[model samples]
Target: MFDTWSVRELANADHPPSVPLNPMGALPCIARLEDETGSSWWVAATANRWTTTHVLVLWRPDPRNHRQERLVWLRKADVRPWLHKEQATRT
Candidate 1:
């Protein structure tokens, strides 16, 4: 369900409005995000209530050190549909 306009404007969106947390049966979607330092990350959405400027993500475990990964909320503007880059690779 990838939209070329960046998953329904998540990448172009301004700050998201604050919402309440819905922890149960969260519908996650794959997204590519760039952090504050401009590091790209592949993450899954978990919740949206963490912060207005952020969206909660289900962080994956680190295989390098076998460390347990914790959930994180990323800047909304940094998130783009995972397959948004698809067209670029095809050419």
Candidate 2:
């Protein structure tokens, strides 16, 4: 879960695809991903999932420091719009 990665010795990842709001454009990415135990996932220091609502991707930059952060949270309705925007933006 987020806690695992958040507290791990090494937690970090590149900027996840920006949310659909920013005009910078969109990148292909997964959402609300879960692990085998049917619980939130914490792999490679990347945490995906927020609460029980399945709406967030919180990335950190090495557990050495929690100051570095990048967050992406989207609603159920944002899925389609985000996907459509990405498809159209793709070359």
Top candidate, metric TM-score:
1
**Candidate 2 segments exceeding 4 Å error:** 1-41, 44-53, 74-91
Q: What is the overall TM-score of model 1 with all chains considered together?
A: 0.38
Model 2, position 43, has a per-residue lDDT of 26
Q: Give the alpha carbon lDDT tens digit for every residue of 36-60 in model 2.
A: 4445443232324433332444444
How many pairs collide in each candidate, listed in order? 0, 1
Distance (Å) between predicted and true CA of 64, model 1?
12
Score each candidate by Cα lDDT: 0.47, 0.40
RMSD of 1: 10.8
Score every model by TM-score.
0.38, 0.23
Tens digits of per-residue lDDT for model 1, 1-91: 2222232223323344655457544544554654334445555544434454665655443334335444555566555444445544865
